[model samples]
Structures are given as structure tokens and as C-alpha cells.
Target: MSTVDNPWELTRAIAPRRYVNRMIAEADGVIRSNSYPSKYPVNGNPPTTPWAMDLTSLDGRFWFAAFDLDAKTPEAFEQASEDLGVLVRILRDTGLPHVVCRSSPTGGFHVWVPLAGIDKAVMVQLADAARAVLPTLDHGMLCNDRTGAVRPPGAPHARGGASTVMGGADDVDVLRTPTVTAGDLLRVTAAFRELRPTVDPADSSPTGPVDARHRAHRSLPAWGEAHMATVAGGRDPSRTGYLCLLAAAVSGWTLADVEHAAKTAPGMEHYRTRNRPTGGRERRTAAEAAARLERQWAKAQERAVLYRYAPEERAQRDLTELTGIVDVVDAMLLAFTASPGRWTRTEADLHDSTVLTYLAWLSLRTGSRDVAAALRSVAIATGIPSSTVDRSLRRLHEAGWISRRRQADGPNAAIWRLSGRFSTPGEHVGPLHDVTARPPAELFDVRAALLEVLEDRITAGRHDVFTRAGLGPTARRTYESLTTTENAVHTVAERAGLPRGRTRAALASLRRYALVVVSAAGWRRRRLDYRTQAAKKLGGKVHGALQRRELQYRDERDLWAWWQDHLIRKGGRRGRDRVPTTQAVLFRAEDERGGPEAYPLYPCSSDGRADHQAAMRFVRGGLLQDLRDLELAA
Candidate 1:
């Protein structure tokens, strides 16, 4: 077969040195060999070792930008097949034909359009065009850097999987090597360049009016061509007719136009012959066959008007309004930090403040009380694990801070809305106005917020009780639950969302680490009450603070550290000195607008550490206690 006729064969002819099969060491000295690209072509001799992850680019070779659809597991592989169909549809709709290879049944695919040493500018433009169409593809494998490495198709994966060609094979019974002549590849990419702007760059949220009609016009031909291929490949006459008719209706094509397009669609005639060939004697002319197709198109037009081609309008909020939303969230978080009880019953329940901040930002950014985002998007933005986002979302939901609405129509995204309790009356969605009402202190995920605080302290050595204890998640949770008051083992277990056995095991581990004191001398003999022996033993006012709930200090030393970090201001004759008194510092900070007071509260205790109890009491009974009191004082 001509190299131009086979994608794999063409690739090999152009860059024969790119392919290599090399030994890879697995567990127990087990060795495997698979095809991987060398750093550069070696004139048919490959390197002895596999390519390293850091070796991202190569030189002196004709390269293509690759979309690597890879699944790490079998389930994902199956899902990838569906994703592949979406990608093919994207290509069809955009009217760009490119070669695609199923690198393995385990769900690995490489879709590529060769760059003919195209200048950097053209490549960049092509990359952007590719990105524009990428959203239509589910989980499309693309890299930010267009010049990155692409694995050759001839070799198996190092993990021991075979590669097979996909798309436009004549026989379903046998796998054929994929091929696209160099000239064809370039022609398709050039066509992509022309169609790139018909639809705006893949910005789902456009700030201004988009040329919807123009985009729709450009998309029609690709849609028809793609459906034509689908019909040919499926060899279903009815579907071919249905799709062709629907395309005509949607595109507003004349019956004559649709007939002409379908007849010349490369494989249309072949499919027509195989599915419904006209016999001899009464030999039907091409005109008669075209009429039959036109009839089908006319039938499909009846239902096509119902399909929507226009983009929906999205609500846009001014940048200042967006900033105001963030400020409100900050204020809410600051208030929560002052008193964890304002949100949760226990301080330890505040797991990661950063995640909470991310959630708040997302909600505000979307200009809605509710946010609908994929967990993957959250994880990427927050730089945390998707699992962590899942856990945090669950905690927030349980705490009554936000409610989740699972997507019913498409994609795996979930909708999250801030609690009505936290929202101001008649407040418009988005960040247009500040929520003036006193922020709610009675509900939220306190632990999620505190995790961010703990992370800071951990880095500063201001607190290490939890980390030093080396407790598992269950143990850590159990220990936190035991901090404020002793509870029955079952109660603690239920609160921590663990099984009885698991909770018991966690409590025992905490006990072993001296983090929790578990007592078994209760009425039922198996009944247990727990307390944080570690915090109570810290001595001085810190110990008293923990017992009386007068302060939210985690450690005795943390109080002084918190004071040094926040309360002390630097404006003395010497240019840097303590502000003298906590009351005075607070007054100065508040008086100077946009000072530390304007920032999120990082309150210190009387002796100088985090004291959520005192902070809450101070805010309630001290500063800004009531408008009536202010009037009386005035």
C-alpha cells in the first residue's frame, strides 16, 4: 500500500527514527519492552532505555500535535470509547479530518494532524483552533505546549498493551493500519485554519455578542460530512437518510443542494450500493437515487426546527462587583475564624479554609448563589485532590453551608448553592452588591476552614499536636471530637462518620499516641468517654482556656505566636514596636481603614494566641454590640 494511504505508514516514512521498543523495569526485576518515541530520530536505531517524562520535545523531525486519550484503568477505557465518538463528532462538525489511532483497547488513543514544518506562528494558530473545537470532545487529551512528544503507533505501551488503527477501516473483522498522506494531513489543517474563527475561540462565557448565525453557517457542511461518514461506516440506509435529511433541515439546505452534497460525499455511493443498489433492466439513473435521498431529507426537515443553534445569554457581573463578593466571603471567613462555633460545634471540624475560599470564589465568580462546577475543575483551581474536594463538599453540605444539586442533563458537574440563611434578603445573584446583613455564625463547615489555618501554623511550628500525633484521618477526627467534651464511643463514632469498629480502632490509636484519654469505666463497661489529654496538660492559662472554652488556643505557645503575628504594630520612634495594648491596637487597626481590621481577623487571646471563644464574646458583647448601645453612647 502507498505510504499516503496509511497514516501509520506515512508517519514511519517521515520520522522512522522516532519509534523505539526498549526494556522497562517493573516490580521484582520483571522487564517489559514497548514502543515509545526517542528524544530524536536515531536513524532506525533506538535508545536502550525508554523515554523519561522530563524529555518532552524533539528536534529535526516532522511532528504533529497529538491528542493522547489515555485511561489508567479498564473502566476509564470503556468511557474513553464514548469520548472518542464525541471527538470524532467534533472533527466532523469542524470539517477537519485527521488520523486517529486506538493505541490500545485499554483506552489509549492518539489523534494527530501533521505539521509540515509549519512556521511557529501557524502552529500556534492551529493549536488555538484545535482548542476551540476541543470542548466538544469529552476529556480530550491535549497539552498546553504544542511541541511536546507524541508516542508512535507501531509500538505497544510499556505497560503491555497493543496499538490498533481506528476510524475509516473498510473491514470490521480485521484491524487496518491508519494512514493519511502528508498532503491530505496538511490540507485538513489548512482547512481547520480557515474554519477556526467561524465560532469564537472556545470561550463558553463570552462577554459580548457572538456571531451565532455565521458560526452555524460554517458548521453545516462539516456536520453533513461527518454524518455521511457515520452512515457509510454503519452501513445503515435508514440512518443515512435520516441524518442527511436532518442536516438539510437544520442547515436550511435546498433539497437539490442536499442531494448533490450526499452524492459526492466520497463513500455515499459505496454505501448506497451496498445498502440499496438499483438492479439492471429498469436501471435507476443517479437522478432517481438522488430523488430518493431528497425525499428522506424532506421527511427529516419536519423535526429539525426544534433543535437550537443559538448560544444562551449568560449573566455578566462587573469586575468591581466580583471583588465585592470576594470581600464578603473574606468577611464571613474572618468571622468564622474568630469563633469556630459560629459555623460548627467544634473547632476541629474546620478542615481546610482554602477549599472553602475556593468554593466561595467560584460561587461569586459565577454571579450566583448557586455554583455548578465539575470536581475536576475545583481540584485544579484549588491544587487539591478531587477526593479532598468531595469530602469537603460533603462536610459543607452536612454543616448546612451549601447544598449540592447533581447535574441531571449532561456532564458530571454538580450545582452548589450557598445556604439561604447566609444570603441577604432579595439579594441578586453574582457580586454586584455587598451582603450588609450580619453574616451568619450559626452554620458552616468549621473544620474545612481551619485546615488552612493549621497548614500555616504547621509551617511556622506554632502548632504540631495533630501532626506530631501521626493520627490517621479517623483518629484525627476522633481526637478533635474528644477535645471539647467527653462523649460515648458510639456518639463519637457517629459524629466522625465512621463505623463503630473503625471509630473504636481510631480512638485506641489516639489513646496510644496520648492525644485522647479514653475511659472504659462507665455504666455499660464498654461505654467510653474521651478528652484531649495533650491540650489539658499544656499548663497555665492555655489549659484553663481549653477547659472553660474561654479561648480557642491549640497550644500554650501558639497564643504568644499569634500575638506576635497580628497584634503588634510597627510604628514607634524606633520605627518598629508593639502597639502597647490589645485594645489600643484594635482601635488603631479599625481606625486606619484597610488596615489589619479590614483584613480577615487573626485574633489573639489576652496572653496572645488564637482564642475563638473570647473573639466571639468580644464581638458580641464588646465592639459593635448593638446599634441601641451606640446611640446611647453618642
Candidate 2:
């Protein structure tokens, strides 16, 4: 019987696809692979077993594509981009009855679960469980470049660059050792484990033509030339998942032959190809994205400046993030800050229990400041070996946030100091001992700052809306009481219990006509600090250049108009005691003898000179602004 409707359909259908006998044929470049599960048929049996697994990525863009061995579309990859919230919500609420794994993508996350581990009935159950759980997602805010921070688009995607986003078949850095060992195999296995994130092994390789289907898809020279950031923490390239080996290759087959296995297997060619890259409108849209990044960077920097209290002369009165910083640099800061607190270290576990205990004990001993000091004293007094403290301190010091300040007189013990700014994220710090070092977030410090910003915004009613935008309840009340009950800046400052010194200063900042002002004595307080028409934001470099270009163009226009007007009003060389205003306007004789003649208007010359030809065009153009070519071209 044909297997379609049979309970044994999946088993019979999936059997000859790749497996031979009771064993599965190894691909050309596969180093390690756990058993993949599915449902299938055996002989004429009513039921059979097959295998399957599904995965998701965490780099922000969401997907929940699945692979079913029984179907014609085994490695078919389909995405639910805007429905990220819906899919993740489904997985979170209605747990699947299968073994699962998770991976991180550039934007969001992914979930990996094997289908064979759970029976088809349970899989159906899982789907039913999620029927009520998936929420409708509104992704209007999650469009191109709307993330409100600078993200590198990666060098404008040069001609013939990789078109599709692909991951490695495995994330293994290959070895050049003379001798192979069990240690090497384990390391190799761990490396490829990361690459399974890709739908195709090509995902782990370069963009151009693939010589072999299942071969290790790595191009080292290409990587070097492109200057890509492959892995976090500067992992050694060889140890990276840029390459993989085919551990299960059939004996006696050439490497070329083995690679052909994956060529037709799960992931073949799936990337969509358009007629061309983009449109003219797309170019304009790209610019808009670039503009938004500039704005967000500026805003984040403006915040930094406000936090730093930069003076008005240095401060731009815009919605920018910081004051007196380059646009891109400020962008980086905002992008980093938007992540909020650093990535915290995983919870203490057996692998690091000793280290955590040692640190905990050390925290107590090293401090003369209250608890820390008391703990340190107890550790030292109780005869906990000083060597243990030394080792713990060494790792902590290496983490950068902590430093060892040794005394010259020398009890010879290390005095570790935490030199981190609260703003200095912990994700950057906690990675010291991590095989893959990454910082741990210091939640306390970050949460404190967030609270301060939220409280005031809530109370003021200034924005008129706050909750959806993230203002705290206390902030709302403070805004209300300050405006309604205490109207004057000083009075409001008093009622708000602001520091005396800061209150006056902050009031001064708010009171400037361009800044803010409060009206009413006590009934209702309204804010008056809004942007003036002249308050435009531009980056430091481009700001000056664009402004200069505008000013120069304006001056030239005025000069041309003024010369015309002067001839009209005074006529040529009238017999009067005129100050020669037109001549003075054209030129001042400090540097040159003759007015106007010293810098005569560039005359149109259709002669052989290139400069003259350009001048002729400009003259005929009537000093047009060329709104078409202006950087702010409409």
C-alpha cells in the first residue's frame, strides 16, 4: 500500500531517503550528529517510526520553521517574522513534548526540538495546547531600522557579496595538529554542535559557488578580506564553527563524492532570488534608515550629556542622546545602553561553586567597609588558605572591573578593587573565567537610574501619555503634584524634595524659553519647553559642513542680489559723495588694491579650461540650489 494514509506511511517514506540497513550513511563533512527522529512505516506494518527536529534563532528576527522527515519538505524553511511574539508565546505557554535546544540570532531567539522524541499524537496535542496561547502580534514598530539604535549593516554589501544570511553547518575551528587525540574529537564535536543552527551546511560556508554539497563550507581567505566579526570574545578562528569535518563519510568514497550527499538531502537551494536588489524608492528608504540611526545616536548621546551636565554652549538643544560626541560614537553608546544591564553570568553551579564560595568569602574579608570587611576578616582569621583568596582575586582582577592593588610593605596579599562605573556593564566583567568570556550585568545600579528617569516623567503629565512609553506610576504622581500643588520651578523643586543645589540649576535649565517654563501658582502646572523652529539637529562633522555650505550659498545669493539692487538704486557712478558701498560690499582692500576687480565674478569661458566650462554652467544656472543634488535633496 502507498504510505500516504497508512499509519506506517512516514516510516516507509523516510526509510530509503538516507538510512541504509540499521545504520545511517554518514555525509561527506558531518563530524557529529545526534540521532534525528521522525515517524515512518516498516514493511506492511500499520505504524512506523521516523525522526525530526525543529529550531529557532535568537538574533531578534523570529522564525519557527520545522523539519519533518516524513514530508516532501523535510528541510523546508518558512518564517513567521512579524509573528515572533505569537510563535514564542506558543512555545512558552504550550510546552512541546520533545527534547529541545535554543540558539541566539542577531536579533531574537530560536527553539530546537526533535519530533521523534514525542509521538505524533503528542505533537498534535502540543499544537492544540497552543491554539489559545498565540497572541496576535503588531509589528509596526519592528520594521527596517526602527530598532532605535545603530546596528552595522556591514559595509554596504559590496558587489557579489553573499546574498543570503547563512550559518555554518557547525561552528568548529579546525586543528592543524600533527597527532589526533580524543581531546581533539570532543573539541571538534562541540564546535559543529553550534553550526547545526543552519538549515543547510552552506549556511556555515561562504556565499559564492559550493564545490561539494556536504563538504566543510569554509573560506578563511574570504573571512580575512571581509573583516567579519565571526564570534563574540575574539575566539580563535580555528576553534570557531567556520569549518566542519564529515566524520560519517562512507569508506572508499572520495571527499568530493561524500559532499554530494548533502547536495540533495534536507537543505538544497531555498533562498529567494529577486530580479534585482532594490528600487529608487528603496534607496530613499535606506537613507531614511541611516537618518534614523543618526537621530537615535544623537538622542542617546544627549542623555549622556544631560547625565554629565554639559553646558548650554556645548549642549545642543535637541532631542539628541548626548552632547559633544561624534554621531557614530554616540550611536554605539546608545546601542549598547539599549541592551540595558549587561548579560548576567549563569547561576552558580558545580563547575564554579568553589570559585563563587571563594569570592563570597573574599568579598567579606577584603572590605573594611561593613559586611565585605567583616567577611574578609572571618575568612583570614579562620585560616582559610590565603592561596585560595589569591587565586579568586586573580580571576576577579583579570575581569577588568576588579583590579589588584598590592601594598608595597607587603603582607603579600592582593587587594582587589572594583573600578567599574555603574554604567560599566557587568556583561563586560563576568566573562573573566568564561571559556567564552562575557560580562555580567550589574542589575542594581542600572535599575536605580531607570527608576529616577521614570518617576519624574510619570508625575508631570508633560507628555500627557506615559505608561505605554514606560514611565513609572510614581513619576506620574510627582509630575501631577509638582505642577498642580507646587507651580513655580523652585516651589515644585521644593515639593519634589530635590537637592537645593541641583534644584536651582535644574530650574535654570528648564526656565530658558527654549528649554522649559511653568505657568500657574498652584492649580495646574504646564511645561513650556518645546523645540523652537531653529532647533535642528545635525551631526558634528556634517553639521558644520552642511551649515557652511548653506551659509556660503546664502552669502553668494545675497551678493548677487545686492549687486543687482545697487546698480538699480545708485546707477553707475552717480556724481555724489557716496561711500562706494557697492565696491566695499564686493571687496575690502586690506588684502588687495582694487575692489570688485580683485575678485571679479568668475566669467563664463567656453574656452578649453575645465574650470571655465564649469563656471559657464554655474552662470547659466542662475545660482540654483540644485535641490536635486543637495545632501538634503528632496
Candidate 3:
């Protein structure tokens, strides 16, 4: 005596399995499904004997609006029957056909309204109309989204409860109402649709007077785009549920609005949550779900408002006030190359150097030695990828050249303050790489002199040797590190903010290109000790240009006699002559033209002997490697 002639449907009604003859325990709880399985168990394993029917998903698209009643004891069954009598009277008034069946032996009834050959939406509308008439019914079940759970007649339930038909049809018609046609139900459904609350899915933004500029044209926020994508993905309805709830909370939408939007969304009906159990309890009602969603939404909003908006964006200082700072910074950077010592070529990578240059410029512009730099914003400014910039900045921090202070719960960029020992001056001074200690004040003086000379060289149009070297970003930065001092690989990488492997690779590339030479200093604990020196050919083009300029000055007697004499000076055991130093040869004309006081290219170092030795090695050892390439004989 089944509605359809499918034995599988009757078997499904008897089984405890949820979907496709398999019981499923999701976040919502245990569900018995009657949907067809894509593949059945094989290799001697049989499918579940009986599966619970998913009434809403059965063929013919007829919707099942079930009303579950609990009586507990035999005596309580009387009240349940009385309640069903009241419900039947209400349904009879609407002329809708229905059934009354027993769910468990202990006494509970499932009064189901099966809409014949109608769309599920229409069925839900019919259920809503029925629910409206019997508003006081405790266990009212509305199958709006086709997600509710319904056990088949004669199925097994918890607590030794066996389901059976109580009354309906000719076989069982105790308290049944007059059966109505499917067309009559459809007509009633069409009428219910008019009464349903409607909300635009796209119009969930917060309610407020739109700004004049935004009034003419409106667009969703970034978060809204993310929310819609999450909903459409349908991977997890729980996440979507929270998102929708939060959206509603922020936009001041009611539960009805959320439901309407969800109902209208294509494919959203497949997300069944209503009949699922949470925490071993039945799924929440529409109002309960809304309230829970609202609480979470409120907490999130509070956290964001308190922590996110408290701090300002970037702190902008007036440019006018930073005039002196800019000029001083510009002078230092420009003169850095001209001043002697191991300071000219920092050997910093292009990205790192570029980042530093920007930081320097910002310090000048912002009138603060400490600058706030965002990796993304910095990448955009420097034309480097954000990932690369991030690596470079990490390297910079490790090198102790810069100090970083991270912002706490703010949109402000990480705060970066130039190293006082290098930028300003204090106890920590002298050569950044020197093992020997020197007075902080004295070291600062030496560094200042070098920077001033570098500035002069820039003004005089000296070529930047780093650019002419044609090295990769990391190699160039590593090369600069090598030029500074002989340090272990880890030390160099740490100083450069590069990975150890990257630093090693960069060294190999530099050696391959003959930019620098690495010599084994000694072996310590079986590890080969290494020391690197810039190849004399490293500054090949600049060396050639300087040589040519020097020759022109020497040939022109119009140049000052002392200058000519100085250029022609000799020093050896037997008074043998040697070429002038690189700086002397390069800067003589500029110095002569613009006086030593104004163009201080070579400031006297406190330790002249040491400076002289460094200069001699720089020209004769480092700079002399490419004498042939410089075309000195030509």
C-alpha cells in the first residue's frame, strides 16, 4: 500500500541510512537520506538494507510539510491527538489534503502535507499558509529550502520507537481531512507568494543617507564581494550561514530578509541545515539562528572598530619643516662614494639598496629618522615585487643597519628607525665591520667625511660604479657585503638580510663574473675560511673614464703647475714613479676648479697611515686588476 510502486522507496523508509543508503553525521547531526547513490558497495558488500527517505527530494518534486508531535506517555497521547484534531480542522478549512502517521511506538505523530506534482517552492508556500493558520502548533515544520528530515512510515527511530501509519486513506482515516487537488494547492501557493517578505540580494548594505558622491552610483564593499563568493561556492553552508548573519547584522537586515535572499539565490536550496542537529539538539528555529548570528556579528564588529580604526594611516609631516633634513641627507648620500674608506660601495643588493634609498628619502621628506614602511607600498614605490621587498627588508633588519618596530593593531606601516650608530651617532660607531674599537665621535667624523665627499662626487657627475657592474640584485648586494669586510657566510647573509643559500649563490655569481675574488684565509673546525676582495676590474668603466680624464689634465699645461707636479709625483726604493691614487686622479680637476674648502673630496683621516694603505690597496690591488681592460698601454 505505497503511493509509488518502487520497492526501493519502501525499503528506504525502513532503513536507518541517511543519504543514498548511507547514514551521515554532519555538523547538523544524524541524517537519513533516500537519494540515489552514485555507486553501490560491491565485492561481497551489500548496500544498507533500509534507508530513510528524503521526502523533499523524492521523485515528482512533491514537497513534504511534516508536523512532529511529542506525547511521551500513553496519557499524553490524548493531548497530541487533540492538537492534531485542531490542526486537521485548520487544514480542512483551507481545503488542503494531508496525512496523520505515528512516528514512534511511545506516541508522536507526523502530520504531513504532500503537495502533488508541484515545485518545492510552492509546497513551502502551502506549508507556510498552513503554519499561519495553526500558529500555536509547537512542532510546526516548514520545508522552505527542502532541507528538513523526514523518516519514512514503518521506519525505526531512537528509544525503541517503531514508526507506523496512524490514520489516513481508506486503510487508516480516523482524523483525516478531505483530500484536495494539486491545482487547488498551487492556487493557494500563488496567493502565499504575494504575502511572503521580499528582499533584494544586492541591497544588503548598511542603511544610511548615501554620500552625495556615492548617491549617483553605488557599489558593494570588498567584504561584500568576498561574502557573495563564499555563498556561491557552497563548499560549507555553516560558513555561509555565519557570513549571511554578519552581513544582516551589519546592514540591519531581519531574519526574514536573510531567508528571502537565501531563497532567491540559485543552488542555495541544496544547503540543508534546518533538519540537522547541533550539540545533540535539534536545529535552531529561524529566530534562534538569527539571534546567534547577530551576537557573533556584534562581537566581530566591536573588535574591528576598537583595534582597527584607533590608529591613523601614515603619519604625514609638513615638507617645509624637513628642508634641512632633506638637504643633509642628500649631501650624505651624494658624497658617500667620493669619501674614502670602505664605505663608498655598500654592496647592498639593488632591491635592498632601492628600499634603503626610499627609506632615506622618506626620512628626509617626513622629517623623522624613524620611518614607517609598508612592504607592499614600498614594493610599488621601488618597482620591486612585494615578496622580494619583504626579503630585502628582513635582510636589512638583520644587518643592524636599520631597526624595526611593528605596529600593534593598527593600519600604520611598520616603524623603521635608522641605526643611530650609522645614521646619527653615539657609543656605537667606527667601521660597521671593523673588529677593532675606535672612539664613536672619531668614527662618526670619518663616516661624515666620506658621505660629504660622496655627495660632491654625485654633484660632479661621477658614474655610479654599482650600476655599471651589471650584477643581479642579490649578487650586487652580496658583492657590496664582501667589499665591506671579510665575514663568514652566515654573517654576510645576516648583514645583508639574505638567506644563507642566496648569499652563497650571489657570491658564486660575482666570482663567475670576476667582480670579486674570494681567497681562503684559513681553515677552522674543517670549514674553509674565506675572505673576499673587489676585483680591480669591478669598476672597469669608471676606472677607464677616470684614467682618460687624468691624461687630459696632464697633457694640458694650462692646469695648475702644483696639480701637474702632484700628478707626476714618484715614490719607491730607488725613487721609481707610480700613478696617483684613484681619488686623487679622479677628483684633482674638480678640487682645483672648486677649492678644497668647498669641494672636500678627500678629507684627511685621523689615521693617515691607515687611510693611505687602504687607498693604495684600493687602487693598486682592487682597481689594478683590470689595467689591461682600462687600455692604459693604448
Best-matching candidate per lDDT: 3
Error (Å) of candidate 1 at residue 274 is: 25
Q: What would the TM-scores of all predictions be?
A: 0.32, 0.18, 0.23
Residue-level lDDT tens digits of model 1 in 1-634: 0012433343345442444324456676554433333343334444434332211124433344456655434323433443454445445544444566666545456665544443333343334444433222221223333334544444444545544555452221111222434444444444433322221112212111222222222245555545444423232233344554566667778866665655545324321432211111122366556555654554455334222211222254444443344445655555443444433343334344435555664554344555665554554443334566677778877877767765523323677765544434364677755543322210111221232222222221112223322332344444544422345777665444446676687677656545544444110111122122443454343333312321232222233332333444422211112222233332322223133323223455668567765545544443422322333334
- Candidates in descending TM-score order: 1, 3, 2
Please report, in order, the local distance difference test score of every candidate based on alpha carbons: 0.41, 0.26, 0.42
Q: Please give me the total number of clashing residue pairs in predicted model 3.
A: 21
Candidate 3 per-residue lDDT over residues 1-634, each given as its tens digit: 2232332445443222234333443466543342333323322233434334444444435444567655544323533554455455445546666666677666567666654344554454455443432222332244433435555555555434446665332222222222445667656544433322112223223111222221101222444434433433232233333444444444555545545545433222222233211011134456554444444344333222222212232333543334334444545454233331223234335455566665664564334666677655554444344576688788878977568876623334688865544334337567767644433222222223333222222211222223333343555455444421235677666544566777787777655645544544210110111111232345554334433443333333112222222333322112112333344333422222232212111112677422434434334343432432233323
Off by over 4 Å in 2: 1-112, 115-225, 228-284, 292-634
Better of 2 and 3 by TM-score: 3
Off by over 4 Å in 3: 1-51, 58-60, 70-79, 90-97, 133-141, 168-182, 186-634
Task: Give residue 537's lDDT in candidate 3 (0 to 100).
Answer: 45
